[model samples]
Target chain A: MSSKSNDKDLGVRKIIYDKDGKPCRSCNTLQDFQFATGKISAKDIQHIKNGTEIAAASPQETILNSKAYRRVDPPGVEELGRSSWNLLHSITAKYPKSPSDEQKLEMKQFLTIFSHVYPCNWCASDFEKFIKVKAPKLNSREEFGRWMCEAHNEVNAKLKKEQFNCDFWEKRWKDGWED
Target chain B: MSSKSNDKDLGVRKIIYDKDGKPCRSCNTLQDFQFATGKISAKDIQHIKNGTEIAAASPQETILNSKAYRRVDPPGVEELGRSSWNLLHSITAKYPKSPSDEQKLEMKQFLTIFSHVYPCNWCASDFEKFIKVKAPKLNSREEFGRWMCEAHNEVNAKLKKEQFNCDFWEKRWKDGWED
Candidate 1:
């Protein structure tokens, strides 16, 4: 089954192969993967070939260097991650204030399937694990919103990013912050 | 239930109320609603208050005028839409070349719930209608990718945007365009 020629041609797998020939989608944060994918620039590929440790550069630095990147190609994994989170959080914000039993069950089912089909293989696996340990809290809008925020913080922690304060999640994601 | 103060304070609903007092999320495209929610700028509000026909401006014009927009707020619906499509298309690209029956079932279930909970209420309703008429084809990667492209085109057609050709789906999404 793994012998499909198109699988090798997919580019993402070839770009991040591990020593054992396994595709290592989780080897670096999503931002670094974007650089490796050539979504940013050929300069990054050149850096990788020269062993210049391009992955060490911050995501902001990479973006600053690639002003033309947005026009040239579709979004890489970082863009995907950010966008998916925005959608998830926005949906949670709009969740019914007092959800019915059916609503709760539907939400739980949705999160479970979302983790399964998420494009980043490693990220999906991690989310699967996270949900298994702490299933979605879908009884009410606030509960679901906080749960989503915590799930995001889990990913942020894994990526060595600062943890977002869950207390302010509604302000951050739904209501605009008060001055 | 209708008396809930927070419901009106949600801003999204209040900004786009129709004659029947329903929050008409579909009254205008998501991009226009973003201006109403202050995701773009106060300048847009000023234009609206002055009866400058701001809604008549194109999306590109709105985006070009919002350089400071990102610094102050969460993503508006348009940004969320773009990001969501990126993730969805990428996931379809990576769907198994020959999916197992279980995998196909899981993908279909995901799409159904995704349509229900997607944050853009109008978009979600439209998708629900689309999927009811033409269910997701999940038997193989090619089928799934083509189905998604067609689904997206349906949305593009509604928004009066140009339809993307599905012939180059893999190149436009999964693989980078050949130089």
Candidate 2:
């Protein structure tokens, strides 16, 4: 574990695969991510007798080892994706029915910056292409929200996740289903 | 559980506690969120024999029962928070070392819209206050990243979680911590 050079320490790298063929931390599951970043080697991991060997091991090693998520590690791809979608859907849910020029511009800029700076390079590239074709329907909240739903469905289709019913977009994203 | 009215079906309600003293689904853990959303009543939850009782229960009953998250429901507050932070930190991690006037403006707009339309109303309100006190320091990626670190630290302090060392924000957020 050679320390990063001073010049490289503060610089941020894109969330992509490493040259060694390991997936980036943010792009894999927590356990895979731990392996990806060399936190635990494939050999050592297979042999990890218990949590005592884990670096800076959490007190509740049993729980941490058993859980799919650990608080100490950064989120992986699925987690990040879900979060981004939640933020995006929630935003569009409240988008004004009639937005001002500034609001529209800001919204456009937000999406632009969002997809551009999205950490996962591969996901960002796909998102960039997706936005290019779909073109944000920014005229009104309804249009924008509908567009977002369709966009989400497209991703869901590609991922083999069930297509969410677009009709319930607003209800699920903004309004909780009435019981 | 009478279904919502026709007029209310498509409406997106703010994420908040319900009149029945249940926290909104997005504000609690999966089990608590489930309880809150009436998917499982408190009594039933306490007495549930198996996954059969879960609405459209997943096949992995034991796994679903013990896990902190479920795919079927919207993200809870903590999940939402972690995801939002991933998006925000990653964005700033790549923000240009020195931004253009337009870039600066867009960044500011992004934060504004982000806070304004954040899904968790209570969290949003606190975020708004945090930003107000911190005021986004968006001159460059370095400044902005530092600002974000401080902002996150403030939240961590409030939540009683340990404060992340800002010095390594880039290493963690963008570049994988050097292994």
Candidate 3:
């Protein structure tokens, strides 16, 4: 009798693998194991702590915009942490209520940095090189620092001239952002 | 005066209506639309086409498995037509290559449709209750048909097993699915 024909009799949704098939990738016990997502065959279930269970006991304050340098090309950053904040910053920065060409260029530059923070165009300097290239004419670093400081002011000046609702812009600027 | 010193002299890249001097979405335009691989303004470019253009004098045969489609949510069938032909059937079907569950599902269903000349699921059916479900299932109709046929065969005959190579499978089983 085929194992497929006896699916109801086996008391499972479906047998993940054929009987007497490949050995387990995880635990040495090749007989019993649950399949995980990503379609990888495994012989053991790795214990991952789900936050819901811990939430009731500890009520810990969640960290916002936390960085995990350990993770490279990590999945679910938007669902798990600061990706939502970053996305909002980008949308607002790029598509401000109203924008001018200069402002757009600034937004575009920042977006480039945000998307890909690679090594410098000249040698191997990091994001610092990006900041310098974006605002090149400055003789001193102090002026660049001032520009970063009043970056919001420049955005606001463009927005005011475009004639968008001031109250809305002020509220968003003051209240911060949610997903 | 320099364009920076006097905004009116800035030409196309000049700021038009700037309020808070923030990133303006409306007024910004791509500065290097003339160059390849540079920023192209969203507003300027139009009429993108994907597919080979043959001369009227002599029509050339299309390369096997060359199709193009846009990417979107619940992705359109037209979008996967090229991928279905090229990558799915041409490559994987020949070798019995193991693909992800999603890819497997796509190929299996595509095979059924590629062989069938009729698009509708049912040729003969009771009509009284068909008023509510006017259209036959679009996504999984072919899968359902094959499953039904296989189930019927299993119930009637004790066994039907066949082993064949990729060339035989492509030539005999798949209709109009060849170079």
Give, for candidate 2 chain A, the lowest lDDT window spanning 10 residues: A57-66
Each prediction's TM-score against the native?
A: 0.71, 0.62, 0.16
Runs with alpha carbons beyond 4 Å of true place in candidate 2 = A1-71, A96-105, A138-142, A157-162, A175-179, B1-71, B97-102, B160-162, B175-179
Model 2 alpha-carbon miss at residue B140, Å: 4.4
Give the DockQ (C-alpha) for candidate 2.
0.27
Q: Rate the local accuracy (lDDT) of all candidates.
A: 0.67, 0.65, 0.27
Q: Which stretches of model 3 miss by more than 4 angstroms?
A: A1-82, A93-95, A118-179, B1-179
Q: What are the per-residue Cα lDDT tens digits for candidate 1 across A1-179? A: 12224323333233444344643333333434554544444565456656677543323221223332222244555777887888888888778889888888888888888888887777888999999999889888899999999999899877777666677667666654534
DockQ of 3: 0.01
Best by lDDT: 1
lDDT of 2 by residue, A1-179 (tens): 12223312323223256434556555554555555455655455545534346454222222223232223445567777877888788678667788888778878777876776676667777888998998898889888988899988888878777666666666666555443
List DockQ for all candidates. Answer: 0.27, 0.27, 0.01
Give one clash count per candidate, in the order shown: 0, 2, 22
Model 3 vs. true fold: TM: 0.16
Model 3 Cα lDDT, one tens digit per residue, B1-179: 11234323322333322254432222232221111112222232221122333222112332223232111111111222212222222222122223445544544433332222111112112121231243222234243323333332332243233322222323222221222
